[model samples]
Target chain A: MENVLELKNLKRHYPIYGGVFRKQVASVQALDGIDLSIRRGECLGLVGESGCGKTTTGKAIIRLDDPTSGNILFYHKEKKDGVDIATMSPRQMKKQGIRSKLQMVFQDPTTSMDPRMLVKQIIAEPLREQGGLSSRALENRVVELLELVGLTKDHPMRYPHEFSGGQRQRIAVARAIATNPEFIILDEPTSALDVSVQAQILNLLHELQQRLQLTYLFVTHHLLVVKYISHRLAVMYLGKLVEIADTDDLFNKPLHPYTHALLSGIPIPDVQHKLKRIVLSGDVPSPLNPPSGCRFHTRCPFVIDQCKSEEPVLEEVESAHKVACHRKNEVRKLVYDQFG
Target chain B: MPKLIQAEDVVTNFYTYEGVVKALNKVGLVVDHGATFGLVGESGCGKSVMVRSMMRIVQEPGQIEGGKVVLFFNGDQQQEAVDLLQQSEAYMEDLRGNHISMIFQEPNAALNPIMSIGDQISESFLFHRKKEMSKKILEDLSADDCRVFLPLKKLQQTLYTIAADNPKSFILIICSKIPILSLWQRRLKREALQRSIDIIRKLSISNPSETVHRYPHNLSGGMKQRIVIAIALACHPMLLIADEATSNLDVTIQAQILELLKDLKKTEIASILLITHDLGIVAETCDRVGVMYAGNLCEVADVEKLFQNPQHPYTKALLESVPKFSQEGRLRSIDGAVPNLVSPPSGCRFHPRCSHAMEICKQTFPEEIEIEENHMVACHLYVK
Candidate 1:
């Protein structure tokens, strides 16, 4: 399978100013040296806590936030060489047709859409950006998009606030795919919704992905939702990728200590299936002054002197499983011995 | 276990411009002493309105039309239960933060941004613990090794003695208006602040003294929630109502808070009424569960039975809709959206979307019946 998107050494830092002259005291390392790849027509789930930079990686790939340094390689069939979107300006991206191929659906549907415009105008905004469609064609396309997202033709005449949360999210999905994008970034798309409505949106996304052969970078903190949608899973901790593996492999036996703790923290809906939870001692450290060496050493239960002094690099411990833990072997043995 | 609180045929309505919104249609439930009761429903399903009506804190344009809320004191079944609906506004005000306190959903919105954390928490102490605090101040003033000035201590002693008898005394109100004389109760205020610090420390917050001095904006979401919990637990209320208190927090922080609440249940609070939409939270924390749909109570059962063998069609569909970990095939979503409460569907509001709805379901509401020992279901399918 061809790779749709590749991120190499991506970094984003926001400088904090203090003192009399407003000098730069320090910088928050929001995204520090992230390396990831998304294959064509595959959903990659990015799971992390609030400040782990999952949204930052999504924004950097779509150029919502400019990266400090790195290469975002986007491949096109006609062009054998992949284009570096990291350096592309807004106009350059539009001119090269990359803007239409990549799109994003925000977390909150209420604030992302305009209240003054009707649903027809909201969906037609993207088609109008692409240009060259007549008024009749645009109207037809708006009606088509509405039906595609499981809404009636009359829905295009209603404003955003007139619909419920589930219906509004459906409108947001309609707008995202209006441009026929091949890859989409869903940033906590279903977090703000109720469980039943969340299930509806998840099913819609699943059906759309299969029908269009679309690739997804599904970023969310909900573990079960990620497990349901993604083919592969990536666990991030304080702006760095700590583990990556197939969804089943990672869920069954996560290697990194952070990944294991995160998986166990989730409260399973079933009453009979009780799994022992590994609750981290304290809160996540601030990104402004992250802990030295391993970022997770401060809260890790199995921390050692070596872990506090030296950083471990991400390396493949198995065929398709990668972990960035110095004590992966010992942790794995202990986990297996206890559970088996 | 004796009943701590019970509501009978609670009906709440919102008189909107469009029409009347029947938010709660004869909702009824019970919470026993030393038990955690979970209310599960989607947004606008009247789970919140039912609790707010019981608390008598429903906002303007909303009114609790007809209901009886009976509150029993402690575990004594022999004692006569008090009808809270017939109580005066002043009596209810005293009962709010003293016997029954509530923790709101959004901590940022619930807390005042300008006030320091210490002052906000201590305010609860001042409201409900005034007599207790004033008695403590009297002890300090009358001690053998007292350090207060002689003349000032004499005036403070008289003031605190009156305060201990009646917190709403007229003489204290007059003295509070005087410029320099108002400072006589400084020792009492200090006592409340000390109690606030102790409660914050009890929640396992490190550096409670420093944390009390900071404002709400300086703290994280989890820390603000802890402050809210501190205020709710200040007076050792009999019932603590947590309305989606942990929904906005991260999973790890949520686990910590849930664990804290479980521990506190064994030590401090008598019973808890938890309102949330997550079934997982209900399964993990609640002893019994009540499922609400469109302002109506559909089912009430033990947590284990509700999860394993759901009786109501709506409850069955709700349990099926949630995605399990690494679930196979397509998810079976509930077919329709929640109905509009302003002009809700006739009869059972869930009939329009229920898979097993019968012809009689659209005509009249079903009476709640006990199918098993501790399980009750309100559905036409179960009525026969």
Candidate 2:
């Protein structure tokens, strides 16, 4: 499969002002130099704590918030070369209809959809904005989209608030797929719903991915949910990618200290499966004034002098298993000594 | 072990603009003394409502329509058992935060934003320990180490005496309204603050003095959560209900909180009622488990047994839906969403979503039957 999306040194920073003149004193480094790639029809799980910039990465990729710097290389199906989404102006992106090819499912379904608009109108509005369809064709497309997301064809007239949390999410999903986008950014898609509903939504996402051949950037804080859905997992700390590996490899044999601590943190349901978790000390540091060198060094259990001074970039120690840590080699032995 | 709390036939309803929403319908469960009894279910399944009803803190428009929440203070002491439903408002108030306490889900929302952490925690002590503080003051009066007299020493002692005699004294209430007289509570507040610091310190919070003085906004999520737990533990209640206690925290922080709770359960708290949607938390922390669906507890069993041999289809579906670390392929998600509580399904609430749903299931609710030792299930499929 071809690389659907490639992010190179993506940096999205918000300037912080101080004093009477409101001069920019510092920046809230939301997404600092994020480098990643997503293959065709593959789900890449972005897992991190709150304020760890997973959401910012999503927004930057789709240019929901125009990134401060770096390139978001998006591959078109027939195009010889990938286009830089970061450089494209909103009008240019819309004119080329590249924006339609990359759809986003927001975290909260309630606020994501306009409460006043009917479900059909909200789902149809996407197709309408994309243009060139008959009124009859648009109506049929809306019904088809609703049916695709497991909702009845007649739910178009009902408002978003009329539906349950799960149903509202289904409507949101229907809207995302209305244009038949090849790549979708699901930002905490099932976080608002119940577990039973989450499972249903996850299953629906899986089915849709298989049927539609959709590539996904699935972002969430829940490791278990991400583990189930994603083909590969990327662990992020304050504004930077710390690790990337296959889902199984990441969980089974995490190399990075942060990843090791993170994977251990997910409490397994069975008591017999007693996880010897390495709970890192302190909370995730603020992105505004993130720690020197490795951003995770502040909370990383094994903080070497080298880690404190020199920044470690994501490097592949093993095939398809990349880690950003000075002590990635030592982490295996440390985890083994403690948990194994 | 004798049951600390025996909640039988609890029927809670919310009189909303739409209609009377039956939040809990004949819900029943047992929490034994010294055991962490976990209630597992999806949100809006009345797990929270059940615990809230048990605490007699079900908010506005919501009422416990019927049923008894019998609490055994020290267990098997028949004379000590009192149905919380029949208790007077004052009696329930005394029982709440004294015998039973609760830890809310969100630390940020749970803690008072304007209040200092010390003040909020100390309020529990002030509310429950007025007599103790008064007795201490009287004891300290004779000792050489006793602090110097206030501007109104006689008035302060007299106020303490009145407060010690009756916490809700009419004179104190009237005095409380007066600007100058309200200062009488200063000594008591100081003692409570001291105790609050000790309590916060015990929750593994370093720098108790600084943390106590700081507002909720100044603290991190974990610190705020610890402070919440400290407040819940201040009274040393027989039962502590941590309602989704670790849901809003980071994974590492969640592990720490869970560990703290486990440790506290051993020495600090007697019995814990852990109400959460995470099956993992239920499995990891709880000894016994109860699975609720739309208001009805469909299954109750030992945590290990519940996970190993789940009888009810709902429980089975819930456990299967959780994407385990050891498992691969598609998770076995239950069909359909939770039924609408206002007009809940006629017979078995879970029948509409159950795979083995029978004709009888739609007609009447199934009674809870003990299939195995200590394992009880309420499902038509398990019917004899």
| Winning candidate number (DockQ) | 2
Tens digit per residue, CA lDDT, model 1, B188-275: 7889889999999999998999999999999988889999999999999999999998999888888888888988999999999999
- Local error of candidate 1 at residue A114 (angstroms): 0.9
Residue A279 miss distance in model 2 (angstroms):
1.8
TM-score: model 2, chain A: 0.98
> Over 4 Å off in model 2, which ranges?
B147-155
**CAPRI-style grade of the A/B interface in model 2:** medium
Tens digit of per-residue lDDT, candidate 2, span B73-182? 76799898899999899998887787899999999999999999999999889889898888787666646776756656767778888888888889999999999889
Model 1 scores a TM of 0.97
Residue pairs with backbone atoms closer than 3 Å in model 1 (clashes): none
lDDT (10s digit) by residue, model 1, range A174-221: 999999998999999999888888999999999999998899999999
Instruction: Supply candidate 2's per-residue lDDT for A138.
Output: 93
TM-score result, candidate 2: 0.97
What candidate 1 gets wrong by more than 4 Å, as runs, is A18-23, A333-340, B76-79
Candidate 2 residue pairs in clash (backbone atoms < 3 Å): A120-A156
